[model samples]
Target: MGNIICSHSLSPLSHSTARCHYLVPTSAYDVFINHRGKDTKQFLASSLYDNLQNRGFRVFLDKSSLRVGQYVPEAITCAIRRAAVHIVILSPNYAESEWCLDELYLLIQTGAPIVPVFWKVRPSEDRMEDENGVYAKDFRKHKKAGKFSTETLEKWRNALRWVSLVEGFISEG
Candidate 1:
């Protein structure tokens, strides 16, 4: 096997145990897609979820489940805890939805490595003036402050493999 250089140090990890010492690869994120169910059109337009599934990711999407009223939040929260990556599909309507906002807060506060996919919205300061723009504000904080670097797009593809399973976009039930 080729020598794998640990990102933390120049020295290579001869043993598998040493490889685990540094931060794990971004691929550890089991993708959790946070979008308004009412905006399925936007989500489908991006095809981000499908692309992730095609790359062999276990994607947790609400469309597949036959969830009734009252229990949805619990189920969604459970999914959030299990996710390695949370992909927020931000739109004008997205900012208005309390569910979307609450989910964003949870994801941000949890310190999970987030990969925001801006949809029909630009990342700008004006959009973040109100607390409704919390997601945008957080993005700006990370980007302008140089706290976040432009991560490679390949990392998103690699993260799919961490999912437990991927249900096809359309479910029989």
Candidate 2:
């Protein structure tokens, strides 16, 4: 709604290809990419980011867009909240990382339309692997580790279950 500002619009960023570590969007974004860093960061996330940017879509990708900051989670939260749509890539390990789950939950909570992409999980192997997938294993780990609260875990579980039911893309090879 407001003016667009990012590495391209800001100082130092406007001066060169050199980008700032700032992750918060100065203007509304067209797309926000949510993915497991190890799972799809290199291939799917990178490619989609490039393609979307090339098509003149304002995008927020943490690895490329975020400026140097001690709190990465804060930046991620900021980007997720302002984006127009979310490209959520659900990989095998998506549930393993607390951050990824947090992002997914935020995407759901933000009321943005999510485009779910199953990274490596075959649809035949597991239904809803892309939408919801088998996150129970990692969830159990979190529970056993005494890391996440009951309310937080429930939110993640509900998000996954809800996302699985949404009409989304299924990447199957």
Candidate 3:
């Protein structure tokens, strides 16, 4: 994508609060990035955020956009809704985090454009249901612990399957 020039200026509402104010904005962001922080925060996600920002895109990356003491769920939901596009980075342990799964479900619900980046994992691996599959193992643990309802777990699985079908980038590293 080429550099996008946004007419509206985005300013922080207050240093003490985690709210941002936009001027006559149709959407708050050109892109919203969803990723497993532990997996990609130090490298891929931060690099992508910086690159996109340098290219003049209004990107919402949780680590950069969110403030201290911010209500995480609300901030994430708002950013997702206001983004024109979403980029979901599917790391090896992506499905292990309920927060990541919930974010994926919400991203699917919005019906917005989504770009999935498979990092060190394949789409087929993501959809695997065998005992040896990492995703399957994590989900089994979730089920055993009763951390999420069966219906919600099903929805997460469906979300993964749906995203795996979408045309996306694959990174061996």
lDDT of 1 at 82: 53
**Stretches of candidate 3 exceeding 4 Å from the true structure:** 1-26
RMSD of each: 14.3, 9.1, 8.9
Candidate 3 residues 1-173, lDDT tens each?
11111111221111111242332134889999999999999999999999999999999998899878766666676677678999999998898887788778778777899999999988887787466888888888878987566776787788898999999999977
Clashes of 2: 4
Q: Please give each candidate's TM-score.
A: 0.52, 0.76, 0.84
Runs in model 1 lying further than 4 Å from the true structure: 1-29, 40-46, 65-70, 125-127, 130-173
Superior by lDDT: candidate 2 or candidate 3: 3
Better of 2 and 3 by TM-score: 3
lDDT score, candidate 3? 0.77
Taking all chains together, the TM-score of candidate 3 against the true structure is 0.84
lDDT of 2 by residue, 29-127 (tens): 889998888878888899999999999999988888876643555556667777889988877888777777667776776687888776665432223
Better of 1 and 2 by lDDT: 2
Give the per-residue lDDT digits (tens) of candidate 1, residues 1-173.
21221122221112132332232232334887776666554445237667888899877676653145524555555565557877766554554344554565555544566666555544542145345464455444434654223441112212222211222232111
Q: Which pairs clash inside model 1?
A: 57-160
lDDT of 1: 0.47
The 10-residue segment of model 3 with minimum total lDDT is: 2-11
